[model samples]
Target: MALTYTLDNARSLIAVALIIFISWLLSENKKRFPFFLTIGAIAVQAGLVLLLFAIPNSQAVLSGVTAAVDGLADASDRGAQFVFGYLGGGQSPFATVPEGGQLPFIFGFRVLPLILVISGLSALLWHWNILKWITRLFGLLFEKTMGLGGASALAVAANIFMGMVESPIVIRAYLDRLSRSEIFLMMVVGLATVAGSTMVAYAVILGPVLPNAAGHVLVASIISAPAGILLARIMIPEERKATELDYEVTLKYENSMDAITRGVQDGVMVAVNVAAFIIVFVAFVGIVNNLLGLAPPLNGEPVTLQSLFGYVFAPVAYIIGIPWEEAHAGGNILGVKLFLTEFIAYIDLGNIPADAMSERTRMILTYAICGFANVASVGIMTGGMTVLMPERRSEILNLAWKALIPGFMATLMTAAIVAALPAQLFGG
Candidate 1:
């Protein structure tokens, strides 16, 4: 057993090494990159993954927290049921069976409302200063260990709880003082992690397939914070003469009532935006797939855009610990995820046959798709930052693509770290 475990770990390490090499190879100023900082970041990521996956006690605690979050999903469903009645949370009204079985996979009905509940909770927590304190602690730790400084670290830390859109507000007052590298780091971190409000929604989506769905998503976002910053620095090696530094976090809520109200309003917009985006994006994908379908069919199946993506990214899936035979399927998921959105990719995942993917492949893909690293996020980041610091609009536009490369790479590194762990983390 020990020998088998060691060999599996060796394979995982090779894959991780590949990911790092690929990251370095893409470095803009390779000579200027602080290699030691990159190494330390990877080491920290690996250690944290072990603490979350290999250690029974810590993993159990995370699993318990996931269960609690899962329960929140259940509670949200009940609330939806109360409002939308049968269509709300009542077993996905889009069944395609002769007997009309409950599909339970409608995005608008099942996933949108979750944004409202968790968003409110996050707001209440922030109003109570719990989130601020936690971000401060993590920011200081990142400053001391990763040299990310206070403001950049705090914004990244806030990405853990808030959505990418709201996190930059934490460091809004210091935007002008930030260096170009710091801006890229902030954008990548945002693009690389999802908000707490939607984490529950994604958790609800993946829960049926992954028991520790919330736990895994949480771990992916947290680890990707450091990984994202590290890769950003590597790709666009910090060019500032001195350093971008800010330690003050002066933002505060007016009151608990105000927080709850604002939180709900923001969440409603998010839910509506998500619903429309998913609807439109899914339709667009179908249109593109149809256009690609005009190509010759292969193996009795039409050659669609998804198949083309699979062909390009299959090698990536294989190296990341997916079984070889299933690599094509995993590759398609990665493409749809990066090109479209994880929301749709996860919907694709839910439909794939369980026998087609091994538990290991499933676990790796789960973490990989946990982030907001799709093409849409690039525009979102560009627009958001342009609004926050219009003076740096030129800089934000130029590095948007640069930040995106590492945004996805950070999640890949997270998946690689998870790949090294035992299958028990995936749960039964």
Candidate 2:
């Protein structure tokens, strides 16, 4: 394929300007806007996208990571199969079926188990100081360029690999004294990116629709770190910079076994929460759609929850480079991501007919909703932060609600920047 740009790609550049302008308008102190800093943040995201997609060497590295993740997923499947037998993709015990016939892959049995394995593996890596060094490097970058304090920068960087609540633990000693801007930035980064362990499940969900799903998912989380910082600073510009610098990782495990054991325990809670959310939220949407169905049909189709969201977010989808004809469908997924979760949204994207939307459209949407920004996360972030800093509960609550705007827009900023590039660069 050849490198090319369409009208939509140029339009996405305009959308990037609009997104930044909108963030500026919402700034707590508009006069304090950091113009050059904003430019630097945008440049960082653009540079990363080009390096990962447009450069052959970087793309090769990304493919290697994707291949390793795929192997990890396969290993997780084998463990699940041993536990759940045929329900988990193991060979069927019955001989009545035709030779070489395959069994259905159960999400709970097959995909959910990857979280446990990845979570344990991530803990093991952290125990080995691998993740710590990588996080420290990114933290230094954020501290220098974004002007965030060492603790805040470290927490934000760790959010790429850790959960919203879990990342804050690394900076627990400074949580009580963290400036409002630092706290807000941590919340924004946490919500703007997904955990590394959960990335496996998301990549698996999107694998059929996107080539190298793991690579894209990984890139999305990594790049969004800077985007979140940029938006957070814009919305809540700090009057003074933080002085206390503590860059060391505070989270510790007694040993490798302890890390794996505790990590798996945490993963169980996450896996169960995901399973429950899917069931309850899908039912809620279904019930609401049925209620809407009794009222009237719109444009020769029954009015459903998704259609309502599609109508509301279609313009946003179009502004981000999805063609107008396909924007409504893309908007629907984006809406689902906002209200429900990215996990559900990715599943919906995968369920769409493969030919219904162009590959570029799918890739755009994939990058767009690849975050933890949603209604549910506001409460999660707030609750988690409150536990870490109970004395500042009121402050935490105030910032948590406000963090949602920048947090949500951060991922959209990433998608808009990606949309500005040639779709062929992403293998679309």
- Per-residue lDDT of 6 in model 2: 89
Per-model TM-score, in order, reads 0.92, 0.96
Note the Cα lDDT for every prediction shown. Answer: 0.78, 0.86
Point out where model 2 deviates above 4 Å. Answer: 94-99
The TM-score, computed over Cα atoms with residue i paired to residue i, of candidate 1 is 0.92
lDDT of 1: 0.78
Compute the lDDT of residue 334 as modeled in candidate 1.
Answer: 94
Model 2 local distance difference test score: 0.86
Per-residue CA lDDT of model 2 for 1-428, tens digit only, reads 67888899999988888888998998988998888788889888998888788876766887787888889988998999888888777788777745665575578897789999998988888889998889889888888877778888888889999878789887787777788888888899999999988888888877777778889889999888898998888888877768465555378889999999988987887788778888888899999988999977898889999998999999999998899999899899999999988888988998887788888888888888988899877877787778889999998888887888788888888898899998878876
Among the numbered candidates, top lDDT falls to 2
